[model samples]
Target chain A: MEFSSKLLENAVNEMSQLPGIGKRTALRLVLHMLRQPATQTNALSQALMQMRTGIKFCKSCHNISDVDVCEICANPNRDESVICVVEDIRDVMAIENTSSFKGLYHVLGGKISPIDGIGPHDLNIVSLVEKVKLGGVKEIIFALSSTMEGDTTNFYIFKQIQDFDVATSTIARGISVGDELEYTDEITLGRSILNRVPFESSLKL
Target chain B: MEFSSKLLENAVNEMSQLPGIGKRTALRLVLHMLRQPATQTNALSQALMQMRTGIKFCKSCHNISDVDVCEICANPNRDESVICVVEDIRDVMAIENTSSFKGLYHVLGGKISPIDGIGPHDLNIVSLVEKVKLGGVKEIIFALSSTMEGDTTNFYIFKQIQDFDVATSTIARGISVGDELEYTDEITLGRSILNRVPFESSLKL
Candidate 1:
């Protein structure tokens, strides 16, 4: 059926475009926005706008930030000796929330997927290697997903950094498979971090 | 745990403030946005900003619109003589979605809730009465909820228009109590419209 207003229809269409939001859910959200006070609606609008205009990927870690370097990278107190490699900024945020990780992060932007045309060169792998070669990093934690692509990316990174004196480790995949690291709850994530094994010892590659 | 960045935290906080969104859902939405292409993220942000800056309530019907009069109110094909009185614009959209009602709408803004300090004057009741007094109105279909506040508002409107010759009617309350008109599926809504009873005759108030 045709919607009452084109604007409402447009808003719903936009909302439905997002992952997990169906047409019905989008409709409900749009209607809820209509019921909200102008101030609240304005705040949501401002936040959304600011998220795009104000934030950019950090040059050092590839994590989203309003400045050149992310808060983690800019913080001098954080350990520069350990670099946690993640597939996305969400994974970095998830790890940071635990307050247990005092190290810096390296967001690969995405996992290496041959079918998806995402190769090692497509990621920030070169920058990671360059950072490692600069010589302060002692450990490289592969906090990527346990998927095929994640494994491929991890193997490629391992090959590229074999010459470095840093210890290479992958976040434990004992109980996690077919799930993004970002989706794993904090408790599970913390456990996984503590239970992580040496990549060379576990993968034998 | 504290968020990774202030902007991300702000976005999450604002999203959580939305009606049904919780902290986890807010985080999911933010992460989803982060994963999307720059253009898609920009579209969402632009839509949110435009929803406030471009949209305004139609003066004639109080429905959300980009122009002064809503598309429904401005449409010449709609039956201006038949006015559907509803609690909100969402109700108006619900009715319009059916394509069965070609009538114009008068949004009461909200129902009478004295406990919540919402009196008759707090609503757009005066404007509704003025519209009825202008003449040429043949019917007024009250499509309010079955709640106490909805019933009270219906009664007040019924009393005010008792002197007028307009055929006063109401959408059927066959659905259960506390059921919002917006939440009722389109098929049920259409059926309710088909089986609507005369307000004055059925209630006998």
Candidate 2:
């Protein structure tokens, strides 16, 4: 892990500090930067610095944005009364890709992971609950993942806004659309069977 | 692959331009940067810029270095008479890790790969020939990978240096030390047998 140049070593060390990047990968990336045109590296560095300092969050949903409100929240075409609660912008993009929902989003930033010292307050739960309390929202759909932390966050939010006269529901859990029944995990298969929709409703899907 | 913020999108796009990084991975890295303290991203950006601008190569062997002469070439203890020619700095570091060779290195930067439009003149081959022609070098070992480009580069150098008094050799091609013989590839197993060294010579290890 020794390097001939201190500059190269320093660059590699800093790069390896990033998540999922190991020392070897850092070295490879640094060397690639060295091989490419200086402008390429300059552009990359400037872009990262500018993004870190200039990135904005939507005031409404706390999703990453270039302005006070994200595009999803700003769009009049999107159904504002039906808010989809998600963990981050990635989930927002995922649901948007499916084109299944025309609702606005309330990004929580991250789930309530107590083990990681992240509680409900660490996320955007306060803003979300306040929005529901304002009384325009009709349905709040929990679109967070089905992990323990995701479930806890969903339950905590539901408890806070339950008496506000807003309908609360969760995304359906089932085997993936194209997955085989034999390959479905036990818990997912069991839940799908237990919550099986009426045959006529399934036919609509 | 859409982004919520223009700054975030720019950073992710630049990041994804790096080898082996996809859009999803780029987004993940950018998001991680956003979650971290601003100073972390600043440090990474500064380090990369400093390394790119200030990095130097050894004037003697063309290896990446902090000064005109590299450590291995400057060291008084290393053998000045023998030289190991390698493809790049990574190979130099790999051989150094073995701690078996005591000679200095000549890094060619890359092999002669015509498919990549790289030629002998494009590499440090001319300087290597000049070094051999100067008559102080006693032996030159071709330590490049055993690929077609590597062999082509090796043969091209050998052709230029054949008239010189220096002896020439290449790294041995054989089964790895701890590898199972039964699983060894046929070409390597065949070559290992065909070029077998004496039993006593191996037993000396």
Candidate 3:
């Protein structure tokens, strides 16, 4: 816990401020940086600072971007009428990796967790409702996780846009393709059974 | 793994370069930072940059310091006649926490390891030998870990200063206090048995 140098202590303290990193881990990381060339530290700090200060969010989707508008939002080929609602940019990237969804995304930045003091007003809910109200959008798919916060946020957003003429749906909850049914949680298994689709309809995909 | 923004990717790439951090963890950390205020990122980067660029090493002992001479070396109360050789500043801090030894420390920065391409020339062995040759030091204690690399580094330094008039010794290798003999590793247990000290000597501490 005792540091020989104040500078070393400061660096370790700052590094430990990050989530999941402890003081010992911070010390190891800072020492690693010290052993490396100055340019390495320079690049790390410079890149972090640049990301924090220069990063932008798409005005339409609220996903992280380098420009005023992200490529997905700016792409004319993508369908803007069906917006997939999700937690953050990571979800956008995850959905994009599948290449199955042709619709655009609406990044909520985070779920509405009152335990963490985050509310509907703190997220990108207003902007999303604004996008829906502007009227060309038809369906809004709730693509958030299955957690309580995800469901709460989904319901909250659904309520906000319920008066407007828009179809609402949620991403299907079922056993993953390669997962064993025996290992599936009871709630998920029950939901999968209740929401079962026609076999012929499944083959169409 | 796919990044929507180049700046975000750069930050994640740079963050992942730190020891023990992988790309997924790096992305998690970078996203956590993005969720936080800009000031948090600024403070972390500023602290790291300051530590890297402004850090100094003690001229005498090679321990990290904020000044030309470190506090340990500059302390008049510390016995400069005896030097405790260690691997890094962390070792110095550990020994200091024990509050048992009053001798000055000589940090070797790292131990000799062929696998890692570290050699005696890469350490601070020359300066330590120089201190002994100047003829005021009485003893040199090797306080490195009991690993092969640690022993190699110790033996390498011992050969360099064997002709000098100073006495030499190593920190005792034994079962730690409060450790059960049955749970101790065979090698350490065997060494502890062979190097057993007198009953009276054990009572002194």
Candidate 4:
């Protein structure tokens, strides 16, 4: 669509370049901003610029943080000996929201997807291995997805630390808590049956 | 959801305040931005801020423009005697896209919505009346939506210009061009039948 203003056209072009936003959606968003107070737009732009410019990642875990060391890694209450390995910061946030895990995290940044030209080297796997090799980690839990790329990365990292004294495990794969048994996919159902826990263990939760 | 970084949280909060975006979609967009080069984020923020800060409205038509008078109002080719009144710049853009109207536009900024506390004073109706009062305009076409608010605003503006000699008209409302008759709403279908044009006029098109 033709825009009368060059500035509006430029802003819409930039907005539509984002992942899921299309030209129509970008226009709607731009028009919404125009209707609101200028201060609202100012706040949004300021927050985005400040976040992009001032953001940092945790030196140890590689999760996004406002400081050199993220809150999870720096907290003394979290068990540093048990590290949960995951793909990115969003995973870290999801796990943290559960409040079930009391351990630290190792963010791999991304899986080993060869189709996208992203290999193990493109991730933060080397730093994770170095952290594990330092030898205080009692157990490294693989919390990546069940995709083939996730499995490959997990196996490669497990090999790198196999000779170390640390024990290795993976997060359990099963049907989601609220999912129906008949609707569950075959692979997940099979895995759930194979990895079934004792009845007494299930009662504990 | 909890975020490790305050800046990230702030940015997401601001982004999600937009019309259709929710927390999950906001997180996905923010994560996509984080994965891209810092320059992309910088460009987006810069363009948004610049557009909001430096944008101007046309003095004559009130259409958004980079100059005192918009390109349409300033163009000698456009018919200054016939003014198309619209609710906003988007409507003007829509009408322009048709490539049929060569008349100047008068943007009302918004419709009259009592539920939203918007009235005639909140719009650019006075300037529109003044344009007609200046005595060169021969006709005023109301190109607003057929909503109740749109109709009220049109009537209010019509009353203001009724004392003048200029003719007044509204855009024709009926079944859409390619709509199926069975699925068309009764009000529109009835109107289409009642307002049917002469067969010779139809052949002229």
**Top candidate (DockQ):** 2
Better of 2 and 4 by DockQ: 2
Candidates sorted on DockQ, descending: 2, 3, 4, 1
TM-score of each: 0.73, 0.97, 0.95, 0.95
Model 3, A6-90: lDDT tens per residue?
9999999999999999998999999899999999999999999999999999888889999889999999999989999999988
Please tell me how candidate 4 rates in CAPRI terms. Answer: medium
The candidate that achieves the highest TM-score relative to the unseen native structure: 2
Question: Candidates' DockQ values?
Answer: 0.35, 0.90, 0.82, 0.79
The DockQ score of candidate 4 comes to: 0.79
Tens digits of lDDT, candidate 4, A44-79? 999988988889999999999999999999999999
Clashes of each: 0, 0, 0, 0
lDDT of 1 by residue, B5-80 (tens): 6788788898888667888788788778876776776777667556655667889887777778888888999899
State the displacement of the C-alpha of residue B173, model 1, in Å, after optimal TM-score superposition: 3.9
Model 4 lDDT at residue A96:
86
Q: Model 3 off-target regions past 4 Å?
A: A200-205, B203-205
Better of 3 and 4 by lDDT: 3
What's the CA error at residue A162 for candidate 4, in Å? 3.2
Candidate 1, residue A10: how far the Cα is off, in Å: 4.3
Best by lDDT: 3
Query: What is the Cα-based TM-score of model 4?
Result: 0.95
Give the 10-residue window scoring lowest on summed lDDT in candidate 1 chain B.
B45-54
| Ranking 2 against 3 by TM-score, winner | 2
lDDT of 3 by residue, B1-205 (tens): 8887999999999999998899989999999999899999999999999999999999999999999999999999999899999999888988999999999999999999999998788889999999999999999999999999999998999999999898999998989999998999999999999999999989977
Candidate 2 - chain A - TM: 0.97
